[model samples]
Target: MLRTVAVPLLDPTASFELGVLCEVFGIDRTEQGVPAFDYRVCGEHPGRPVRTTSGYAVVADHGFDVLADADLIALPASTNHADHPPQLLEALRAAFDRGAWVMSVCSGAFVLGAAGLLDGRRCTTHWRLTDELAAAYPQAVVEPDVLYVEDGRVLTSAGTAAGIDAALHLVRRELGSGVAATIARRMVVPPQRDGGQRQYVETPVPRCDADTLQPVLAWAVERLHEDLGVERLAREAVLSQRTFARRFRAETGTTPHSWVTGQRVLLARRLLEDTDLSVDEVARRSGLGTAAMLRHHFAAVVGTTPVGYRRTFRQTA
Candidate 1:
């Protein structure tokens, strides 16, 4: 359903966030069996150079007119968010009113707020600026901790890599996990990261030899169908239970149990899309143990029953 995407350029663009949108939607992946979106990079004036924060300028081939036909309109971060052209704000409102998906990355949420789109809607921006966003738009319910939030057709993401997480989530929701996974594989990013995950980890990832859990975590993912309790993982990592627990939280920003549960849920999602396995079989293979348990956790994490999720995605797959 998301066939066309339009991104309007503003002055002093954050190139990394803009690049995220281009990488996710602009690339031609039809050879890989993923749908190719009609991706448009637009400026208020066609062929005008737009300044980027990285000390470079890029030109847009299209103008704001292209947005009228867009299935989605994504906003990248800019140095200036409080003030946008009246026409740009009106165009955003018109696109939203016509039921097109609208998304913002980091400080770009302020543009959406300025457009009156965030009013009475739950949204989020980067954690560093969450209070600013909330204060500027008092009616908007701003969730500071999460990577992203989806309310109706609008999506907002936190800083940097979180944009990839949020964009892949939208792809998975609209095109099925298989398509999202293909795109992620080509991009060399994890296929899924729960939007509810903390935006700020004590350490974004393990950076030292002693602190790195890469090997143990990789080992755990392959053996997710087995019991991945802290005791067992600690034994594999050669650390005592208490030390392992402390380090796991420091490295991954979540408990071992929570991380394992998330992996299992991801496995269950893949099975639902790629196989004809019954709910009970999927539960067993995903290490969920039982159908009732799968339904409970699947709904809690995925916002839908296993059966419903399969029915919706399998059609596209």
Candidate 2:
């Protein structure tokens, strides 16, 4: 029963992002078997035309009063990244004080940070503005590489499309994966993107011409129960360890060991959600060897214990 209220700040980009949220949360999807949200679009002033960066004006039907009763408040990306109006900041602070889940899309993190909601919280913004955000708000734990960061109630997305991912994540968290999947299928977008994935680049995808490592990755994924090492994969790729390490990082934006660990963690999550395996069995099957080791890596990467994750996501069969 999440009630969503979007604060459409003055600017084209922010308005468009607000429109995106509306398309996702405001639409009545009961025909598709998806639960509908109590959604509202609020502006600083009621019945006023707000200017957008997209060279148009949008008239809002409500004002900040809608936010006071909202269970969730979304701050869409703003054109002016450096400044937030005093009244808007005060309104957001009041909303947060009332225990509402607050979220931001792309540069919208700037607005949240300005309102002091993101202080000491792990958050992310568009990768292009990561440096500026970090320099401006040193207290925020800024994760530049993540597509989005869900730090309890305060969620922030990396960029435009990543906002959709973040919104779907909220849907999954609140309404369940089945509902989220239905929404995604209707929108023709992936049900989920690993939050840790790098943002999509406009540059052409690099062709893996010299890559003898395709088989190695496939083999590693299939045999995740076994201990894996760079040297072992290097042999499979027909390259020395050093050469393999360099190539792996270049292609994946991560070290080989890190990539293997991530894959194992992902496998463990799937098992936890889809099976009733004991922690020890899941750890063994995912190549972490022991329950204690699973807890350590799971806590580090997934930010939760295996048992805890299962309790949250396990589907009853």
Weakest 10 consecutive residues, lDDT, candidate 2? 197-206
> What TM-score, to 2 decimals, does candidate 1 have?
0.64
User: Tens digit of lDDT per residue, candidate 1, span 1-317?
Assistant: 99999999988789999999999999999999999899999988879899999999999999888888789999999989677878778889999999999999888899999999999999998878888999999999998767888999999998877889889999999999999999999999988754343313222322224547888988888887899899999999999999999998888888999888888888888888899999999999999999999988887666667887776566344
For candidate 1, the clash count comes to: 0
Instruction: Note the Cα lDDT for every prediction shown.
Output: 0.87, 0.79
Tens digit per residue, CA lDDT, model 2, 74-140: 8788778865667778777887787777889889999889989889999999877888999989999
Query: TM-score per candidate, in order?
Result: 0.64, 0.63
Model 1 misplaced regions, further than 4 Å:
194-317
Top candidate, metric TM-score: 1
Q: How many clashes in candidate 2?
A: 4
